[model samples]
Target chain A: MNFNSAAFLVFLPLVVCLYWLLPFRARKYALLMASWFFYMYWNPLLILLLLASTGIDYLCGLGMDRFDGNPGKRKLLLCVSVCMNLGILFFFKYWDFFGECVSGLMAFCGIPYRVPSLNLILPVGISFYTFQTMSYSIDVYRRKCTPEKDFVYFALFVSYFPQLVAGPIERPGDLLPQLKKEHRWRSEDLKAGVRLLLCGFFRKCVVADTCGIYVNRVFDRLLQANALAVAGAGALFCIQMYCDFAGYSEIAAGSARLMGVRLTRNFDRPYLSQSYGEFFRRWHISLNRWFTQYLYIPLGGSRRGLLIRLRNTVIVFALCGLWHGARWTYVLWGLYAAFFVCLESVLEKPAGKITERLNIPLNNPLVIFTRRLYMFLIFIPAALLFRAGSVQEVGQIIQSLLAADFSLTNALGSLGMTSFSIVSLTLTLCAMARIYDFGLYDLPDNGNRTEEAGRQVSGVLMVLVIALCWLALLATEDAAGFAYFQF
Target chain B: MQEWVVLRHPELVLLYGLALLLCLMEKKWKASRGWLFYASCACAAAASAMLILQGADLREAAAYLTVFLLLMPGVRA
Candidate 1:
């Protein structure tokens, strides 16, 4: 169920209450059952895939531990785990895309081979949980972490409800240990969790959803809109995506916090990053760290020559994009990011010198402003690919943006938006800028008060604002599914 | 089509403009935190109202502004 939905509103509290009420020893089992129920809400059949993966990884972890001294046996266990995790991910996520591509090529060659498509419904959060489970086996094999003896805790670690869907992909080391601890309920933790949930709600329901209306409309009619509209849509898509995904992460982390479990923070103030390298570091930190530790480092990382390091970076990002979806657009998006990262690496020293010579204080208002603008510009094209229905649609949108019809009135008139839209658009921008300015680096410290009094005030205000927004959303009757659910 | 034009909605524009004005004023005035928060809420509500009324193009612009606002702090730092 969607975190924004009324069903989830009821569901979350019920689970949280029951979880706390349960004895410490049974909490993990309680969570595992709740997580399965949560996943089942999407598709009952999908739970089997989860159970299968859980069973495989749990066995693999045990095997790795058992054969710890036998190098050959440990390697075999690792291979089995990799193959099983990747095999499942490939079958569920990429099989259709690969099948279509192969069939299309066969058709072009006049061959009559037609592979029957499975038309499988991708189990919700398969990509996320698979990685979580894989990390457990790999870590155990590498002697980095011990396998959990309790099957239930391991299962819950793989299927924790908060980061289960669209993740700040949790690692076994970070999350597994937390599951073993007795979860104590603290009022401060609950308050902090509630604040985070409300913050996420505002970001998703108010900011992201509202933007989606415009982005979807403009993108849907790409051929008709002018360059301004196309550009506006492209830029808007980036914003919508960040708010939507990050909003979800905030809520997830917040929800977990309410239970006294801390999920890794998914995003820093990513847009504020001066370099593409910095952006990746700040944005989707959990995923980046995961790929770096599990994939990049294993693939020789930067320990090798410069060229190999660059190649590894590209490979990781390309795969990262593919992990997002089966589509080529995601691959292209990955390549687009990889290109910037490689460029940043290549120009790192020179760029540093330039910044020094220009004496651009990193925190100076102008420097910060330019950095944000640059980030927005870089993301526009990447996000265009993300928003497009197909690769061809991306070209059409780009072509529309490059065309010569620059009249503001014609562009705005064609959109046929009401006066209220303009006002909302303007005010939202202003408020967002003010908030961003206040809390970019330290999101939790937006109110700029460390004093208990200030903390209480900010916390209370945030809660009240969120409550009112939730009430408003409920009243509006048009509450929509979160954008990330489709992924 | 003429009736749909948002330029005709003076009251909506005024409410929106007032909300923006209050937000800016809140920053400068250093009033009670509650007052500042209420003003911000009023601005957010007014903006949402404006968004609901406007066409997709204007909504897109609004979204851009909202995103910029959201990220501006991060970008600035």
Candidate 2:
């Protein structure tokens, strides 16, 4: 269910209230039931897939424990678990994508072969839950974590409502232990949860949704768009995407926090990064952590050699791109990132020398600022590729952007914010967001006790103001569905 | 406040400016209950400013105060 929807608005509070009121032993049961109810709210039958995944991993974990002394049996069990999770993911999520690719290939080869496409519905959260469960099985096989013996806890861990759909992709080591712990009411946790929820709503409703309006308007008319429209849409899209995904992450983390569970930090103000390598480290941190632990490191991480590392990077990113969707654009976006990462590595020394030759201080503010600007400008094309419907759309966007008119009026008018005041407000809001990220107005946290208490009060006030703004905007605007929900 | 009135009056600028100032001051000085006092004042000032911006009709001011006060408990948390 959409987080901003009325159903979820009702569901979250009722669940949380009941959860805190329940006795400790029954709390998990209440949460598990609530989680299932939450997931089933979207589609009743899809709960079967969630349960199927949960059952497979639970048995796999137990089987790994059963065969702990036998390497062969453990490996076999791990394989079965991985294959089953991936198999379900493939059937539900990627089958149509695969079919279309094959059919296209056959057409290109002048062969009249065609694969029949199934009319299957892609289950929500299937991709996220599968990876979560698969990671559990792998962790168990590797002896990184003990297999969870209790079925209910295991199931709850797999279908935890907060991060169940769009995830911070919690690892067994982190999330499983929290599930086992007995939690009581903490005012501090509740305070933080409320703040995060407010911040999340403001970002989603005010920033992302507002940007989405302009982005959709321009992107939907790509064929008729001017250069300014394409560029504006591309830039706005980058904002929309980050706010949408990161907003969901914050809300997820906040909800989990309210339950006394700490989910991993998923975003770290990625747009503030000066480099693509740093961006990946900051953005969707949990996913990168997963791929690094499970895939990249296994493929001989940076330990082997530079070439191998590059190869691994490319493979991981390409797979990462494919993981986002069945679209070629996502694959290209991933490859685009991999290419930049490789380029950054190769140019690191040369660029440093050039800066030194230019008498630029290594820590010069100008140098850092320019690097941030350069990264953002360079990111525009990649963002365009991501927003495009096809490779040809990407080309058209680029061409239009290149052919953009130099007139200010055309540029400002293209995004439908023809009025100066609206544009100014939007820009001011964007600037405020940047300043907030940079901690320019950040209150000191670890200080005198009085100071800390005062800061807490101010923080709450900030939350209220944000929530007020969100409500004001939300009353006039429709909330946009999160961009990452498709994955 | 009505959209045209808000556009015409500079009261929003004053309220937003006061909010921004309080925010910055709170960030700068952590301790003092003085900051809390100012925050409350800022909220009241914003409401007053909204009323003035809307031409000081009690009904409009009441609406502004109602919305502002409604947000108070959440911030109190």
**Deviation in angstroms for A458 in model 2?**
5.8
Best prediction by lDDT? 2
TM-score of 1: 0.83
Error of 2 at A94 (Å): 1.1
Off by over 4 Å in 2: A353-359, A420-424, A427-477, B1-4, B8-77
lDDT of 2 by residue, A343-387 (tens): 998788899899889988857888788888888887887888888
Candidate 2, lDDT over the whole model: 0.75
lDDT of 1 by residue, A1-487 (tens): 7888777889899989998999987788888888889889988888898899999999888888888789999899899988999999999889989999999999999998876799988777788888888878888988889888888988898889988888878878899888788877898778668767866876777667667767777776779888877777777778778888888998898888889888888888777777788888988888788899989999999989889999999999999898888999999999999999998788888978998999878788887888778977988888888878888997887788778778777566545456666666555545544444222223344554222223343333344434444554455443556656656
- Strongest candidate by DockQ: 2
What TM-score would every model get versus the actual structure? 0.83, 0.86
Give the true-contact fraction for every prediction, in order.
0.08, 0.02
lDDT of 2 at B73: 19
- Least accurate stretch of 10 residues (summed lDDT) in model 1 chain A? A449-458
Q: Tell me the lDDT of model 1 at A338.
A: 96
